[model samples]
Target: MHALREVGVEVPEHTLTAVTGPSGSGKSTFLQCAAGLDRPTAGVVRLGGRVISGMKERGLSRLRRTHIGFVFQSFNLLPALTVQQNVLLPLRLDGRPRDPARARELLARVGLEGREGARPGRLSGGQQQRVAIARALITEPDVVFADEPTGSLDQETGAGIMDLLREAVDRQGATVVLVTHDPSVTARADRVLRLAHGRLVQDSWAGTGTVAAGGVPRDAAAVAGGGPVR
Candidate 1:
C-alpha cells in the first residue's frame, strides 16, 4: 500500500496549516512529499504555482533555496557558521546578493539581535531555535515547512517559538505548513489536517470551527473543539 493514499489538501496563501497524527501515521511522509524532499509515488506537488514533485534534484534544490524555507525540530544550524552567516546561507546558495541588513533585521526579529557573531553551539536550545527561525525567514520564502519545530524545547520555549511563527504569518504574510503531534500546537492552527494509516481522516478549520472526518461533517466539538482531531 502507498504511504499516503488518496490524500489531497489545498492550503491558501498566508495561512498556518498544522498536520497532526499519531506515530507511523504518515505525517512525516506527507510533509516530505509536500515540501519536495520526497517524491510522491503517484501525484503532483505544487509550490508557488509550479509543479515540484517531478523536478530533478538540481531544479528542486534551486526552487527550495529561492522559494521555500524550513524549520526543523533539531535546530539544524551549521556549527561552523556564525549566526548571521547561518541566516544568510539560503541567499548565498541562491546566488542572490548578500543582504546583511535583511539578515540583521530577521535576527533582531527572532530575538538574536546582538548574538549574530556567536556560533550555534554557544547558544541554548531555545536560542538555537530562534536562530533557525531567523534563517528560515531571511529569504522571505513563499512557504515555510516546519517539522515539529517545538518538539525539542520545553513548554515555555516552545510557546515562544510558536509565537514567532504566528507572527511570521500575521506580519510577514508567510504561508506555513507545520507537522506536529502536540494538541496545544494544533489548537493554535488556522487549519488542522489529521492522517491515519496513510489516509487523511480529518480536516478541521478554525475559521469555520468545523471538522470533516471520513467524508462526514461534524461539529468541531466532536474533536475537543479543535484541540485535536484524535
Candidate 2:
C-alpha cells in the first residue's frame, strides 16, 4: 500500500510529537516507516543519523531491537507470558542478559508492580497498555513509536496512557513519535504535525509560534476550532 508520499519531517530528540490526520491519511504508515517497521518504496529512512531504508532484514531487525521501541493500540503482549516476562522479552531477544530488577522497576513505574505474575489476559485494557509501555522501554530505546496507543481505551484510560508517555519523555529522555486523531492527544505533544492525503500539511512547535509549510499555530483554540486538518 502506498500510504505516504513526499513526506519529510524531523523528530527532535527527547520530545513528544504527534501526527494527526483523518483515517487512512497515512498516519500509521508514516510511523511504520520512521520506526523501520516498514521500508518506504522510495526515499530513505534515517534513525539517529543512520539510513535504515536500504538495510537487510537481519540488520534492520537488530537495529529495531536495539534502538526502536513500539507501543501499539492492540497492546501486543504475548498472551501466555507473565507481565514481567513480556517486558523483558525485548532485551532477551537482543541477546542481552535479563535484568529482573530493571524489569520490576519499570513495571512499578507503570503501576503494575504486584501484577508482574499476571498474564495479559488477566489484566484490564489500561493495565495491558501499561505493560506494553514498560516493554517498549525495556531497552532504553532511542525512540518510541506509539501508533494510536490509546485508540482502544476509554477517555480516562487514554489520558492515563498519555501521561505515561509524557513521563517517558520527561524522565527517561526518550523520543516519541505518536500517531493519533484525537485533538486532546495532539495537544499534549511538544510538537504537532498534520498529515492529509498522504502528505504533511503542517508542522508546528508548541509555544514557539513557529509554523512550517501548511502548518497551523500550536494553540489550543486553533486546534479545537480547526479540528482534523485533513
Poorest stretch of ten by lDDT in candidate 2: 221-230
Which candidate number would show the highest TM-score if scored against the true structure? 2
Evaluate model 2: give its lDDT. 0.82
Residue by residue across 1-230, what tens digits does model 2's lDDT show?
A: 45786776666688999989899888988888888877777776778889888899999999989888999778789998999999999999999999989999988877788999999999988889888888998899889998887776678767877887898899989899998878889889998888888877777787885465454454422211111121
For every candidate in turn, the CA RMSD to the true structure comes to 5.6, 5.6
Superposing every Cα of model 2 onto the true structure, what RMSD results?
5.6
Residue 17 of model 2, lDDT score = 93
Candidate lDDT values, in order:
0.80, 0.82
Reference-based TM-score, model 2: 0.85
Instruction: Give per-model TM-scores.
Output: 0.84, 0.85
